[model samples]
Every structure is written in structure tokens, then in C-alpha cells.
Target: MTEDTLNSASIGAGALLSVLREGPARTRTELVELTGLARTTVSQRLDALLRHRWVVAADASTSSGGRPAATFAFNRAARLVLAADLGATHHRVAITDLGTTVLAERTADVPIDRGPESTLAWLAQTFTELLAESGYDLADVCGAGIGLPGPVEYLTGRPVNPPLMPGWDRFPVPEWLGERLGVPVLVDNDVNIMALGEHWGGHWGGHWAGYPEADQLIFVKIGTGIGCGIISDGRLHRGAQGAAGDIGHIRVAAADDEVVCHCGNTGCLEAFAGGAALAARITASGVLAKDSRDVVRLLGVGDPEVVHLVRQAGREIGDVLASIVNFFNPGAIVIGGDIAEAGEHLLAGVREVIYKRSLPLATRHLRIQASKLGDRAGVVGAAVMVIEHVLAPQAVDTTVTV
Candidate 1:
């Protein structure tokens, strides 16, 4: 390694831990060489990590001859994270290792509008059940993350004036869950966590498997409402007030003025294209579609009118996303949620408008595709969010010091 390169590498225990997380194992000499730190300095950092069980020494040696050299690897199983994906109509909870691998998970139709106290009580109980099912306990949990289907004040982990989430305004989500779970809790919008899951956790393999690794990506969820999560330079961009991706409420150009939105807006994109809106349209057509899931089921049954409406809904969503594509110029846009599960018709409409309306430079390398993870995206993303926060450099340093 170059002297300048060696000089630039951080020599902290957290820095070393970050390298170890990249996989494989390294000996103390290799760690010194890679981190560009003195042998004694490397030993000190490694000792701290080993003491905290953040890194473990392999039993085998990596030596050609003479004294055996010990190897160290990041202990991905050192802690667990409890993650919950709470939608307006459904919720899911999971227990994952530090690596974001789901060890145990459960999903139910418990609605979010049940109010924070009741919903969170159910969540806390479910988390306990999942941990025990996974052979772990609250003590093994490092942190918890939740993705709500509404606006959230990310810094405080509280919902803020969410339209669909009645009785959840300014609710202390983190505090309520943390008090029960005995760990730090983090909360964010459902689509944001889906974006994180689409970006960080991928147990599903499909055509768009390659998109999650993109540094700049957009994840659009078209369920009861339409929203997006932006990934800029490989990190979630929550904007000021954690409301950056509330694309559904944006006024749609040339939208029907008569279409009313739950937020009391007349021309909002969600009023025209969201799942609830589509379901209402289906109901008007004499078909019974309770929600977005019903819309997908109707699409499965080849209901011609539902198909037409879903495609048109996709077009309306695309109309709004075209401007987003031009402005953000993301590397990829992943489509998810119940409406998206309606299949390729939505994607076709979206691709048609996006490719036609977006600037050439933006469209040149942009990929618009379906979410591989599908319904599991939210829960997986929730786990990933917790894993990143719990194992962050500052958190790691604090853990070692503590």
C-alpha cells in the first residue's frame, strides 16, 4: 500500500471493525498492513473489538510455518435487531441478526389505525414471541426499527400528522417500543424502509436483483397511498421533516378536479392513482375491491376493467415520476406495494411515460423495474435500518467504550 494511502486510513477500532465486516478474516499483521497502523496500535483496537465480542478470532491459523497467526472476523451474530413494518392495513415483525438476515418473522392483518397504544402493544408482544422463537431474548436485541405507513419525524421517531394513521400524530413510537423491548428504537416511513430493504436486504431473486446495489435508486410504493423513498449516493435521503418522498400528495397536472383525496386535496396524485382510489373505482364499476390487495386479486382474475384502471393508475403515477426522474436522475426506480403486485401492466404504463417524458441523460441508464423482495421488502428494510444504526461507527465506538 502507498504511504499516502496508509496515512489516510482510519486507525480506530470502529474503522477496523468496518473492514472486518466486508467478509473473510484477517490476521493481526494483515490488519496492521491494511489499516496502515502500527502493530501495537492495531493490537489495541483489535483487543477492544475482541473484548466487546464485535470481532471474533478464528480457531484455525493462517501460517505457512512456525508460530500460527490468529485471524479475526466481524461477529455478525453478536446482536439481534427487531424490525416492524406497520402498514395502514397490515403489519409485520421480524428478528434479524446484525447482518440483516431474518432469523424469525411473523406477519398479520393488524391494522395501524388501531391507535398507537394498542398497535405498539401488539408489536411489543410479537417481538417478544419472535425473539423467543428464534432462541434469543430481549438482552440479545441491540435495537429496534419500525416503518410506518405515514409521515414521521425521523429524528424523534414519531409520526406527524399522518392522514391514514388516525390517533398516531406525534406519537412517541421509539419511546413506547423501547420501554417494552429495552433497546433503542428507530422509526421511519414504510416506503423509506422498503427502499432500505430494496437497497440493503435482498432475499428475493428476480429480474431486478441488480438494482438494489445502485448508489442512486428510488423505491415507489403504490399501496393504500402512493409514496417514494429516495436513495442518494447509497444513503436514504429523508429530507427536512422526513417528508421528502411524499409524492402522492403532490398535485397532478391535468388531474380530475373532482377527485378528492383523504388529505382533503382535490388534485393530488394519490387521489387519482393510489390503491384506495383504484379500489373505489372498481367498486363504482360494481366489483367489490376492499383495498389495494383486492385490486391485485382482481388483476389476477383478469378483470378487464380492473386491468384498465390499474394501467391508467400506473400512467398517472408515471406522470408524476417523470418529473422526479428528470430532477433526481436516479440510477434505478423499483416499483413495490400491492398495486405494483398487480403485475407488468403498471410497469408498462410507468415505463411508457418515464421513458417518454424524462430527459435523455436521465433515461439513458435508468432502470425501472418491479421489486424483487415484494411484500417482504418493508420488514427486511426495517431490519437493515436498525442494523446500520446499531452497528454504525459512532455506535460501535460507544459500545466498545461502554
Candidate 2:
């Protein structure tokens, strides 16, 4: 073994704990091969990890004509995680173990506003009550993951000044939750988590999770407003301002040229295709006297105008998707939103326009469809935030030696 290759941190308890939290590891031989550590160094680290019960011995395996060596795996079940989704109109909290089993879950209707103080307090109280009722102690939790709408500075675990979500600018969501939850906290844009949850355990292959190729998968969200979560090369691409996937702000001329967005802009895609927009449009259409939900039922009954509005919304969204396709060249696109209940009529419009507008090469292999995860996508994404942070946490995990 090389003298300079050994690191003192390898012998420390914290480093050992970090490795175990990440996942299972092989014998010293395998760890050395994988981590580029010397065999003796790997042995020392594993020894510490084992003594602390952070890692446990698995079944022994035969090597090339040598004595059987026992494997080591993370004690995942020993730890639990807390996750939450602070939505626009409602909020939800869940506690789960490493196996992703839900031990406690609760929902609240705080309807987050410009400032987050009241909402944050409500979250803390709700979480406390739910955990107490479920018999899970806070100290036993390994971490907390929170998802919020709008752009977020993931490095700082804070939300940016998103126009729609006022009063939450620069709010340290993770730190606030961490103080209350008493564990490391991770915060991310809601759409990002939704993409994670939906894709990680998507229904594409039924019970078992399935994945499209990792090159490019776009998750388009149409809620009160619109947004998107982008995955490329198997990683989330948070932009310079941490708002890479804010697609709702994209300009779409379909709106009356003077139609101004809440962001004070004209012709935003959200102004036309968002759920709120759909509701307003349907209300104005007069043919559908009910509400947006009724529009879905009406469209199903072959109501001509309701069908046309749904198709038109899709086209507006597709126009924006066309630009996104040309720019990112995603392999597949998943549409998610409350109005998505409109079903195939909704997708048909998006596909028709995207195919017509996007460059042939860009749209040629692009598979456009609705997110199989549907309403569960956001919640699942919240859970995945905890998993990803625990696995390859950005601020704490990566290191380079001088």
C-alpha cells in the first residue's frame, strides 16, 4: 500500500458512518478496489464502521480459490427519515424508514402564502403530532426532506423569490425544519422531487419501477401555474439561479398579447395552460356551466367546446414544449397536473403541436405522455429528496484533497 494514499478521515467514526449511510459495501478488498483506498486503509475504516453497528456483516462469498470473505451492508432499517411537501393549497408530511415504508403520515391545509412563518409553525406542529401519534421519536430520524414550489437554492436549502409563492424569498427551509425535526434537512424545488419520486418508482413497469434512458427526461407540471423538472445525464440540472425548470414563464402568443402574467409579463405559457387558466377559460366559455372538474366530465361526454379548450391548452403547452425539445432534446416527456384528468384529449393536443413545431430530429425519438405517477408524483418526489441527499449529498459528500 502507498504511504501517501491513506487518509486519517478513513479511520474516523464520522467517515465510517457516512459510508454506511450511503449504502452497502463489500469486503476490504472490494472497497479498496472501488474507493481507490489501500487494502489496510479499507480494513481499518470497515472495522470502525462495524464496531459502531453502522454496517453489518452479510453472507460470506467465495473468492478466487481463497477463504470466504463476509460482505458488509448498511443498516438501513435502523434509521428513519421525515419528508414533507408544502403545496400551494395544501401540505402533507410523512415519516418513513430506509425501506421507504410509511410509518406516519398527515395532511394539512395551511395554504402557504407570501411569508412562511405561520406555515412553518403549522408544519412543525403537524409533524410533531403525527410522529408522536405514530410512536416515532425525532432523535431517531436520520434527516428531513422538504419540497416547496418555485426556484430554490439547493446549496443553501432555501427558496428563491418565486413570484407565485410570495413572502418565502430566501427562506431557509431546511434549516428551519432541521431545527424543529432535529436532523439534517434537505430542501429542493417541488417539481424536482416529484420527478424523482415518479421516475424512481414509476408505474411504467407496474409494481417494479421502470426508467427510460437517463439521457433526458422532462417532467412538466401544470398546477395553479406551470413548472418543469429536468433530468439530464442522470442528474438534476438546477440552473444558475436555481430555476432551470420554470417553464411556465415561457412566452406563448396564444394568450391575448396583452394578457399579463402574475410575474408581470405578457403571453406566458402559464397564462394560457395553467390549471387556474383552464378554470378561468372554462368559466368564460359558458358552454361548461360547472367548474374545471366538470370540464373533465364534459369533455368525456363529447362536449365540443370543453374538448376544444382542453386541446387548445395542450397546444399552448406544446408550443413551449417545442422550444424545450429543441433546446434540451429530451428523450421522453411526462405531463403532470390536476387538469391532466382530462385524459387522452389533453395529451393529444400537446403531441399534435409538439410534433408539428419541434425540429424533426428533436421530436423524432421524443416520447410525449402523461406522468404515470399522477398526483402521487410530488409526494414521492419529496421522499426521494431524503434518499438522494442521504446517498450523494452535495454539500457534505463530495471531497477533494489538496
Instruction: Give the candidate number with the greatest TM-score.
Output: 1
Q: Candidate 2, residues 222-261: lDDT per residue as tens digits?
A: 7777899988875677888678889899888556777888
lDDT of 2 at 265: 86
TM-score of 1: 0.94
Please identify model 1 stretches exceeding 4 Å from their true place: 1-10, 59-61, 64-68, 202-213
TM-score per candidate, chains pooled: 0.94, 0.82
Q: Itemize residue pairs with steric clashes in candidate 1.
A: none
Looking at model 1, report the run of 10 residues with the lowest lDDT sum: 1-10
Highest lDDT among the candidates is held by which one?
1
lDDT of 1 at 349: 90
Worst 10 residues of 2 by lDDT: 393-402
Candidate 2 has what TM-score?
0.82
Off by over 4 Å in 2: 1-40, 51-54, 60-69, 99-102, 202-212, 287-304, 393-402
